[model samples]
Target chain A: MTGKLTVVGLGPGSPQQVTPEALAAVAEATDFFGYGPYVDRLDLRPDQRRHASDNREEMSRAAAALTLAAAGGSVCVVSGGDPGVFAMAAAVCEAIEQGPDAWRGIEFAVVPGVTAMLAVAAKAGAPLGHDFCAISLSDNLKPWSVIETRLIAAAGAGFVMAFYNPVSKARPHQLPKAFEILRAHLPGTVPVIFGRAAGRPDEAIRVVPLSEARADMADMATCIIVGSAETRLIARDGNRPLVYSPRSWDAASAGKR
Target chain B: MTGKLTVVGLGPGSPQQVTPEALAAVAEATDFFGYGPYVDRLDLRPDQRRHASDNREEMSRAAAALTLAAAGGSVCVVSGGDPGVFAMAAAVCEAIEQGPDAWRGIEFAVVPGVTAMLAVAAKAGAPLGHDFCAISLSDNLKPWSVIETRLIAAAGAGFVMAFYNPVSKARPHQLPKAFEILRAHLPGTVPVIFGRAAGRPDEAIRVVPLSEARADMADMATCIIVGSAETRLIARDGNRPLVYSPRSWDAASAGKR
Candidate 1:
């Protein structure tokens, strides 16, 4: 029997955000592989088994899952947010490329879901309504210099920036440094949104201007969105403000560079 | 009773891709407003009224929805793909900002769903595995020069780019021109994926090297993803090739500029 491997996104820590297609994929799988927290999010039947590993072991986890699939076991690899966005989908593809040739025959499908940036942007009233870039601030797989270069390029091109892995216990300086670099190119009045655990019970969405934006406002679970020069904020009498980047950009006056 | 306005994403034309939150919002709405095709995607109850308009009439549609919501009608604005990404969420926000102080008093929520780029990336392995940017190639709102500048900047920064609205009957030259500009900055070996109506019945995904990419492969319904310089393709004996951009980058050797 030919085995199958399906990659599914659980959609940013919320049951309501999970799609019917993702749920159906999970229901059809016999085995699941993912980080401990992500795997724990699934309600697997007693007949199904889950192989949970540390978050840093994506490559080995992918390989192990592929091996199980190669042995004719239906397997699913789970990721928080859309699997295509800096998640397990890439790891699985990399594994198939480097692993045994027989693994190539395994049926592969990726079920896309709501990514963190989109979830965060929705809660903040569409700060990503215009052109945008998503960058992971963690320097684990890539160097800080590469991150800096991308940040400068994204900001210079007038794209709103959505940052994943913005701050962690080990990487405390990167987010602050990013803010400094963005301030150099954009106005201090541009809004910076820190959306943490969106769609979860403990969700928090905070909006501040670039001049007063701080690194301490974000954590590993947080997705930070920095607005472009044209981004706007609408303040209400007794409610949280709405932040959004306008869809129209006048080339006659703005962002020729 | 206070009125409520909810914006929901329908998720790339597939009913299975829609989230529970979006469904709930749609069910609760007394009136729906959107582009005709997007509004038609919903199975509305007899009591629910739909106000379908042309695609270019976003501002008027948003204003009409807000007017209904402000007058104590439960309103929903429908968008294909995640509403915040070049969709109705921004239009709603723009309307609220420009319309009236009373519009600010209306309760608002945005329900995020699977975006076209993520759906396209999922269908073609994970081309967005690293830092990436989403740019709309249409010149309806912005000048063609702005799009050109963004393409250059995104290519120079080594970003995988997901292009929305790559080609339309009105704007055929822009996409071809975009390809010409990208070839100057990126290697000809990079992969370009044209994914049309992903998750729908007529979904089509095609992959080609940048040197062989043509604008004819795309349309208004397509999302085009151009892999970064580090992207790789793994061939299979009988299956379609897998394309992905590696999550890791060596700053010492790559994209220092």
Candidate 2:
């Protein structure tokens, strides 16, 4: 039986971020598969099969979704944040392509959603307005050597960075290592915004110095923004705060136009 | 008279990406102001004030929205991507803070929406799954020197980079300059994905080597993604093609115990 797979992005926490298109995709699916925490966001029917697990089981979970889809189920593989940014979209596609012969007839499409970077950027102001990049501190799949190379390049380039998978139960020291690498090139006083569970109920964001940002507080759900030297936090009246990433600033005057 | 300003993200280019909450926000607003190209996407009453203009006029349009909000109008300030990125929310806040006594009392709230970065990331597989940064090449507000600094830092950090406002009428060479800086630290063969008018009818995405990417293509409406060395592209059997950014091959090779 020929089947199809649709990868949907659940967006940042809060139901408000779920687009109508994503909801419609879920409604049309014969089954749903995703990380356990994100699966709870959907309303599943009795006939729908849901394959949910922790992040560690992403590969197996993806394989299972492809298998189900091959068996004639129209499956929606879901992810929190944008499915393409540190989420499950790529994994699912990889699994489908490499899976057994039964999955050959499956059609695939990836639908986009709001990502944590943009969500946190919105919450924290314009820290991402200029050139930026995101890196995961977890070394589970990548060599620390490769990550280090990337970190050095990113820091030297002066691009603002959004860090995902910074720290978790299995790897407690990754974030600190990343911070240390960044400190080599960036000044200690550069602004770094730590966003914990952004868009979730316990959302917390604080601007701290690069040297003072706590590595222990990060997790798969957290997003850390390390700004360029030009990034600044301005405290305005009425408790309105703005983070500005100076895309254009004269080095001689150190003032933005 | 009391008034409020609510900024909404339209989510790339499609109605499917508009969240229920964003729809509700629009329904509740008494006035709406957005980029002229997106004016047709919303259902508005004839009496509602809809302001549209060229992209360069965003700051002025945002100022007008703030003025309307200050004058007892419930206004919805619409941005294509998330308002907090490079959109109108910051401009609105800045205008209100810098304006005369008339705009001091207006209450403002920034709403999150899907961004082009996430859309492009999804289309190009998971180029942003690890660490990444986004920057605008526009020198209208900030200078090229600061942009260079951020680009170098991002490159050194090895974070995936997303570029917004890469080129405009007056700044045609800015994108190439930014590319040159990124090329210095990044590998020559790194994957660079250029998404032109993503999620729109005339959408186009091209994958090119970092060295050969500056072949006279990118423009103001484009969002460019430069993947790290680990990013790879694979062609599927079907008509649909797939892109993959393996966050850490070592983790994937650990073979899911």
Candidate 3:
């Protein structure tokens, strides 16, 4: 009963972004487990078995996949973005570490996919071109105060930030609070990207200055990009402004060398 | 004579990691421009013109791609990893913003690829499973002091850190300096991964503790992944130990909300 388990990232929302490695894992799998929407993207055949479940069931879902794999069924665990980033990879590892010793026998691997942050960064030009920090604003696993602290630390450290799961029904006010902290530490002209549904057909990217950004602009499907102090918004002719942070950094009067 | 310019990420190394969109862009392009090593990856036909140049000439290479595109040629500007992340996308945008305004008239798009940090994270079993920061240690564009500041801030914030261009012939001591800074704030047992040539035929991944990490362990082709305080190293059966950061953050004692 040595079945293999592979956690795969399905990219953002476009099939065009799916890598051959991830595609191969799905094609070779006997069973699949994922959130309903992401599992639906696989379009499985009648022979392919699937276990569609609710979101935030990461640990349970990983345990289930391991249990299946331990019983001689190859499983493909899927996530919307890169499995390694706020997705199933860590959950599965946690499951394997804390579960019965038999769970360790299952061969496990994670195939990285094109994460939404990268897709969103590309769609909104190169706001993440330089140093950056990625934080998931969903406080389901941690406290809201921790999220606020990270946001402030990231802002004060001058990191262009990519915020995932910025706003959900349960976590509505956190995004605004985050923005307030950013306004205190960052310039008002910093470009803020409300990248909703990136890489999808109906993708919409709204770039606003920090002074004009609002909480209503983001939802669960959005990836909010807050550029660093050095980030620039370059205006183009009859096109949306391009956002980016040049590679260079200015650090003249700093702390001790 | 309108032309289109697309910046494409070639993924880490394997052709299998490339997305269909990036391949489509390459197939449709008449000219390619990139660093010598990355350009060598694109085995194009005689009809496809290539402009391979020395490394660190990102701006010039981007200007060349834009110039070719402005003259009615479809061009694909290639980067080894995701182009928008410390790669050619920002350079191209900078050129468009600073170069002749005519370059902006050309249609521009960025097709994201699997960056090395993600690939490295996958290989290491999701060390970046939680919040993380990516800092490029190359001081060519930024001051060395800024890199030190980022290292300290990332460590203090408990964010797993990914270092790009951590070492080179010219910048030999920065990686060691970085380790010194990280050692001050982090425990000695923290995992450090020297992911050299990820996804390539000669890929080598070394998972060591902060106490054992040395500057010479990394090179230009390496991406250094340093785990956070919460990261764990799980022992495997007849395999290298897996490293991952749990999804949950211990924030019971955070500051005021």
Candidate 4:
């Protein structure tokens, strides 16, 4: 059989959140390539091989997966959340673009899954109900300046912000800086949600106002969502407050602008 | 029995894209409620009732669903993509916020699924792999000026844009206008992807440069992704070209800025 490569998302560490399409891709592949924890999520038959690596080794993992597929073995690259959202799909595409000419011919497909932000938003009421943006705070790839610029613009444009890779041991201060920038652009009353390991057994979801949002609230496993100026927090007795941005912004304000 | 309300996403019209969690919710629900087409997507047993409503009647539909759940029925409100993203989740939240006090006691949950933009980006080789924003061009709820402001801010900040509700019968000219505004802020070389009914049998994915992108290329079912300045396109023989925004941005430029 001709070598084929498929990248699929396991979805926020939940077996229930994984789609049939992603599962189908996983079952058909002869080999799996991904970060250790993500790869461990898969239930593989003895005939299938697993190539697990460290989290930061995206480029190398993509190259290795491509090489395996080029050698006529079916390969599956697994990612946590949707493969297209700051994940393996782009890494594989990048590898194919710059790699050997033969690598371009390999059949490839990406099976989308419930990304972390969406899952996180669901756990809350619907902070992402209106316009929103997803930005990864990992400076390992992009500059911190770019992240700052995007955050300001997203807040200025009244788009809800969903942040991935909010904090890590290597980058302890960026999330704080991000919160500071957002506070300047948005009202202090806007809600900030830190969803850790959402959809997983240890999932913890917290909501705080922008004024009280702290860097310590987030870790690498967290996906943080900062509400736009229009985002609302509804009080619910004996339960977590529901947060949602109304579908309609101030129509009167739009007229004035 | 206690009342429960679960909002679930059907995932861009593909049965394969729906998650096990969503399916389980559908199986357990005593009634389904949503827009006509979305409600039609569910395979209901005779005992399971469906309350299909017009697409524009979101508030009423949400109220009706909440009323059912409040009356001790297991209710599931379905949306085409992820319910939290520009879908029914917010509408339900809004209804609960403004409706009867008794509505607060209902158990509520949202099951996230593959959103249209993610499905579209996957088809186009991860155009959203980098920082990105999702906007709706529809002016039915918000003013067009708000959409325009967001377009300019997103483009100026170098964020990829995924547009939902790009064109509809009532709003034919908005998308063309949106393209014009985007063209002003973004380079003409940026790639625009028109993914209609993504992940479904009738899915059609098209890629075009910014200068050549037109309103006719998209419809209401389409999710249009506009790449950032750094987005790349890779060509292949006998296949559609791959489009992806790299994870890394220009670090040198960031330092200068």
Interface RMSD of 2: 2.9
Which one is best on lDDT? 1
Worst 10 residues of 4 chain A by lDDT: A248-257
Give the fraction of reference interface contacts each candidate recovers. 0.91, 0.67, 0.87, 0.93
Model 1: which residue pairs collide?
Answer: none
Off by over 4 Å in 1: A251-257, B251-257
Candidate 1 lDDT by residue in tens digits, A113-232: 999999999999999998999999999999898899899999888999999999988899999999999989888888999998999999999999999999999988899999988888
Taking chain A of model 2 alone, its TM-score versus the true chain A equals: 0.93
Per-candidate interface C-alpha RMSD? Answer: 0.8, 2.9, 0.9, 0.8
Tell me the tens digit of each residue's lDDT in model 2 across A1-257: 87888889988888888888788889899888888888998888998777788868888988888887888889999998788877788787667557775564577777888878777777776777556677777788777886787777766665677887778888888788889888887888788887876667899888888888778656666888888776766555575466756434545424221
**What TM-score does each of the candidates earn?**
0.98, 0.87, 0.97, 0.97
Candidate 2's TM-score on the B chain: 0.90
- Each model's lDDT comes to 0.92, 0.76, 0.89, 0.91
Over B1-257, each residue of candidate 3 has an lDDT whose tens digit, in order, gives 97999999999999989999899999999899999888899879889988898898888888888888999999999998899988999899889889887887899999999999999999989899899999999999888877887888888877899999998999898999999988888888899999977777999999999989999888898999999888889998888788999999865312210
The full ranking of all candidates by TM-score, starting with the best, is 1, 4, 3, 2
lDDT of 2 by residue, B83-151 (tens): 777887767766665676567567766678888878877776677766667777788887677678777
Q: Comparing to the true complex, what docking class would candidate 2 get?
A: medium
**Which is better, 2 or 3, measured by lDDT?**
3
For residue A12, what is the lDDT in candidate 3? Answer: 96
Candidate 1 docking quality: incorrect, acceptable, medium or high? high
